[model samples]
Target: MQFTQIEYFLMVARLEHMSKAALELEISQSSLSKTIARLEDDIGVPLFDRKGKSIHLNEYGRIFYKKAKKALDDLQEAKTEIQELANIQEDSIAINVMNSKLLPKLFFDFYKKRPNVKIRQYVLPDKLAQQKLIFGDIDLMIVINPIVDQRIEWVPLFTEEIFLVVPKNHPLATKESVSLIEAKDEMFIVSETGQNFRATENHLFEKAGFTPKIAFEGEDLSIILQLVNEGKGISFIFQHSFLDTYLDNVKILKISNPVCFQTVGIAWNKNRKSSFVVNSFRDFAISFLKDSANKDFSN
Candidate 1:
């Protein structure tokens, strides 16, 4: 019933553990448990199912969780609106990217144009980033192949192709392009399983009708590229990698058969109110991507 009680309940519901939630909220576990018990008593229903020391939000709890989160978000939006009216709103945006390694130049470039705007960037997987986008916790997301949702606005920013890479003087290094079938026997350096980059490569490999002979799998892209650079194996690389990466030791070849390309996009909550600064940056991003998309990174 109370504002603080609702805040506590929402946190407990999200974490699904009293101790973890208390630690996050900087309060004692006993106090958080008592607060949840009082909240359930006031609501006239048990919100969580307890087993041993663990807990799970029940059906009623899920319903309340959604409604309570929205109510809080709406209250925050109202406060922001008031600040905007007085011309005192903060100029900032929070963004989460799946492949954030390719974005330093973009952020630095934007900073040069809008030095007064504050930016917070996070590197997260596509699905988790989408969840935070829906929750209004993040203002925008830069994702590859975003999910279709009614409450989210998705705009295609650019398409970046995947190219085969090899150390100089390798057999296939002289070729301008190669088919996946032709390279099926080549020992490849690839991303580790369960990685987003790996998932993208996996899909392209599946569509190309052959599994690669992987010589090494790494979670760190720098290490994988290093392996390719050492003549240990060949690998695929995104075109955007050429923007900042030093590829003088490696030869980047186009993938002719599959023409594997990833469409990157900007995603945001359609219902969340936006500030003038956010809108300005969105426009700047679209223009930036447009210009970059036209450049050829194949050299």
Candidate 2:
């Protein structure tokens, strides 16, 4: 069937009223009704059940609706990709990133490579990022600690060790590193339940047979850092998430001997078809990281 037919079907199915759907589509009510009838005839199934002015999509229609939405999205993505290939213009990339210092380095590098394409970045917590990726709200994600899901394909970018953020004046700040047992009683400023970081923190505490006195719970890294700076509580975060430049009051200390580490990665829906541009970006990211890692190793 034609795209217009599918559009009309979706609108009518959503509105459930011929007049309302027609008004929304800027078409005559009779024309809308006729088009629906024609579509049903063409498809050889009754798509909607009429109960006076109200209507509901039949089982076949409900199934068709799901497929139709995916088809529409694919068509739109294809059109965008085609236009982008024509002149490398008018394309946008959406990425959900777990807020971290390395994010800017990655984003700026990608932007330098593709100045024409608009990059939409969403700072999502790990759990929400995973959820969004699965639901197709985001094209891909750069998560701090990768979460496994059947719907996503994850590629490892790197691994980073977790560090404790303590105020410089705090007693633990003088030490080069601290163990879980040493910091067991310290009040913690932790990420909320959904994030993998929070999960790790909780796991460590559970392993050590202690529950930290969590003073603040949030998803924002900056906020978590700020709380630690204020001496409200100490926080555990990935080293990459903390910039080395300097914080006014907080000191980032490594945790040992069982170093807490998390793998940072990019995740995208497995079922979604990859465009050449997306593939290029992914390839570039992989190659760039490999080269960078090799350079570091050689040095």
Candidate 3:
């Protein structure tokens, strides 16, 4: 009946465990249990099918859960609308990106033009970024190999080829191009499985009909490059990821067999209403990237 009770019930329903939900909600287990019991009593039906310590949502609970979630989402949207109206002059936008290196220059360029607008950036894995977009936690996302979703509006930014990187002194370093199968037995370093680059690596290896011997799995691109510099293992990297600093110790080769490439873009939730600042940034970013890509092509 109460908003707090509904919130607690939703959390319990999501986690399906009293102790875990209580810990997450930062409330005592007894209080959480009493709250849910009261909610069930008021509704005149048991929401959960309880068996010992585990609980699962029954038919009634499933129907109510969807309604309660939507109610909370509506309340959150209302709060965002009021906040935007209150601060119409100075606006803030939240964005998530797969790569941190590309953001500094882009954010700086935007900040120089729109000094009053506040920009918040987050670097997250692909799965987490998509989740935040779905929940309306972030206004926009800049990503590569974005999963296709009906709820999202994707604007293409640019595409770049993925390269195979190895230490300059490695056996295959002198080759103009290398097939993925040739390197099947070689030690490889790759990003964590959820990342876009990692997915591309897996696809390339799969197409070449061999599994790579993964020596290290890391999240940071800089560290991955450093590992290659030390002759620890080779890795797949994006074309833009190759900096002059890495040129001395590393050699980047094209993948001849499959010729893989990834398209990076900006994605926004179609259902979430964007604030004025968020709308402005979305337009500006799309235009800016399009222009940049055009100039690169012309040159």
Candidate 4:
């Protein structure tokens, strides 16, 4: 079957309506129908069930659709890789990251050093970023709690302490540090479920033998901090120099008992071949982080 036929099949499989798929594909309904029929004939099995002018994938169709979609995706990825290879001198580096706040400085520093290198950065949740790295959709990832996978390698960057944050006027705000169990009854603001920070917070609470009463859950770190500033609830945050800007009405309390923290790292898939620009960027990032770490210690 033609590659276009596979493309049409996937489109029809997704929409499950011949007329709708035809409209979206900008092809005549009859032509789309013929392509689907020809595809089924070539495979020697009826892929879809037709009833009352609507068509839906049957078991055979569902199985074929999954494999066909993956095949097309692989082809597209190959084409992209080929194009990147052909234009290696004007390379673009794609990175998936957890923290976007650090990217502006990091990207600008890299750009200043290598003016021709293009950087594409994405700030995604922990699990989604890991998925992108594993799928070779991105060249690298900056993340916390790097998942242990044989296909992926992690380079340790640094570790930051996780602190319990509270509104300045809260009862526990005056203390230098507090235990998770001490605040067990207090309402907590936390990141959404799949994030690394949220998971770390949950683990700390669980270790303290209690689950926090979540008052609010958000995807944005700034929003979580805002909720704390509003005295909605207390939450956990990584200790960072930049956090001072957001802490005018909030207090960062140390976690004395569990001493919760997360290790940040750069992760990349070992199976994927690195282009010259990708390698150079990776080396530059490692050197930059090392220098920054040394400066932090010297200060």
Candidate 5:
């Protein structure tokens, strides 16, 4: 019935775990459980079917969730509008990106133009980014892989071709570009299996008709680059890597033959009216990269 309760309900429903939701919301688990139980009792129906260590929403829960979501969204919109009418700048936008390094540059250039807006940036893996987008948790996402959703609108930001990175003294490091087949026999230092870039590596190997001899595995880009620089193995990176790092011993080469490229873009909910902050940030991000074409990025 209360706004606070509605917010708690949405969080609980989204997570479907009492302890997890409670930890996230900074409330006691028992308090959260009691609150949900009371809400369900008041409605004379069970919202969630509780099994050991799991919770699934029932039919009534689904119906209530749909209505509750709309009500909360409408309330937020009303508040935003009212704040605007009073000449107050009060709005927050959440951005989910795989690369954490891109956020500061993305926001610094954007937020300078709109100083009053609040920005929340999250560094997440590709699958989680798409999941959060579909769940309406994040307002916008900058994803490398294309997320085709009817309710989502995609705007092209930049196109980056994957580069083969090696130690400066390596023979292949002198080449401007190397074909996938040429590097087929080389060792790879790649991300984990479920990661987007790892999948891209798999596809590259599949196209070359040979499995790469992977020498090392890492999640962080710096560590991966360090591994490569130490002559552990070669790795793939966006062309931006050349400009972003000061590692003197690393060399970058474009991948040719297949000419593979990842399409980076801005994605937002099509059904929702985007705020000025979101749109402005979007415009700034696209223009910043375009203006600095062939320039280096730090990460």
Candidate 6:
């Protein structure tokens, strides 16, 4: 019925023993028992199954516990939002980059607007970025496949196709588009296994129904492009990555069977109190990426 009652109920639900829950809650066993009894009376349901020294939540109690936890979460989120709105601080923003291809220009554009603000950026693997976000070590994450977490909020910026790249002289290069099955046996030059782009392309492999035969693993995009150019092996990359660059003997082709694409997004830890600079950058990134996607689509 009340916040304290709900909180006590949740604690008891977690611990499943009244005396243990009371000890942990720093309340007397008698008081805790009376409060829980009052709560059950108000709710008009027997919430717990008791056997002298042992206690466990019944079906009604289980349902109530879930709803109570969610209600508390909503209230906490509202409180955090209000506090952030009331205090607009201009702190340095820390960002992590998992999808690195598009972030340079986006960060540069933001830097131009807020000339006095400092924007710290780091390129990290998937797991480390998530740990940093959870611990409040980072403010924003630019990623293709955003981390899925209840406390993390993500906003989509743009989507781009992942193109198959091969040496221009390769047989498949002559074809406009071919299914990944067409080159199932070809050795693949790829980024290291755990990188974000590699992870996205890994899904394409799953959809295409085969694992790639790896010829080499390149640490950077240019290395992959170079290896592909030499006819060493074929690779996959984003369409927008090499749009302005000249590909001497490399061809960016399309896979028709299972279309490979990734949606890039900006993610932040909603639990952290973001500064005005970080929020403004987030707003600016949404618009800038929308415009970029439109312009690229038109071209």
Tens digits of per-residue lDDT, candidate 1, 1-299, equal 89999999999988898999999999999999999999999999999999999999999999999999999999998887666444466578888865434477778898776676789888665667788989988888877665589999989887888888888878888899888788888898987785657888888889889988888888667778887777899888876663226556888888898879987888889898777667767878777776666654443
Cα lDDT of all candidates, in order? Answer: 0.81, 0.77, 0.84, 0.83, 0.76, 0.81
Using TM-score, give the best candidate's number: 2
Clash count list over all predictions: 0, 0, 0, 0, 3, 0
| Candidate closer to the true structure by TM-score (higher is better), 2 or 4 | 2
Model 6 is weakest, by summed lDDT over 10 consecutive residues, at: 82-91
lDDT for model 5 comes to 0.76
Model 2: residues with Cα > 4 Å off, grouped in runs: 1-87, 207-209, 242-246, 290-299
Cα distance off (Å), candidate 3, residue 241? 2.2
Q: Cα RMSDs of all predictions?
A: 12.4, 8.6, 12.7, 12.0, 12.7, 11.5
Q: Which residue ranges in model 1 land beyond 4 Å of their true spot?
A: 1-89, 98-109, 135-137, 148-151, 192-196, 271-276, 295-299
Tens digits of per-residue lDDT for model 6, 1-299: 78999989999999998889999999999999999999999999999999989899999998998999999999987876565445433347888864344567887887677665677888776678878988989988877776678999988888888788888889898988999998899999887777777887778889999988999985566777777888899988786674317568877788888978888888999988786668888889889887887678678
| Candidate 1, residue 66: lDDT | 95
Off by over 4 Å in 3: 1-88, 100-102, 242-248, 297-299
Candidate 3 vs candidate 5: the TM-score winner is: 3
Ranking by lDDT: 3, 4, 6, 1, 2, 5
Give me the overall lDDT of model 3.
0.84
Candidate 5 C-alpha lDDT tens digits along 1-299 = 56777788889999998899999999999999888888888788999989998987899999999999999999988987766544377667888865534456757866566667788888677667767777778888876665677888777766767778888888898888888788777788998776667777788778767888888776566778778878888887775443336567877887777777676777888777777667666777777755453354323
Summarize candidate 4's per-residue lDDT along 35-61 as a digit string, tens digits.
Answer: 999999999999999999989999999
- The reply for model 5, stretches above 4 Å from the true place, is 1-79, 82-87, 100-105, 149-152, 242-246, 270-276, 283-299
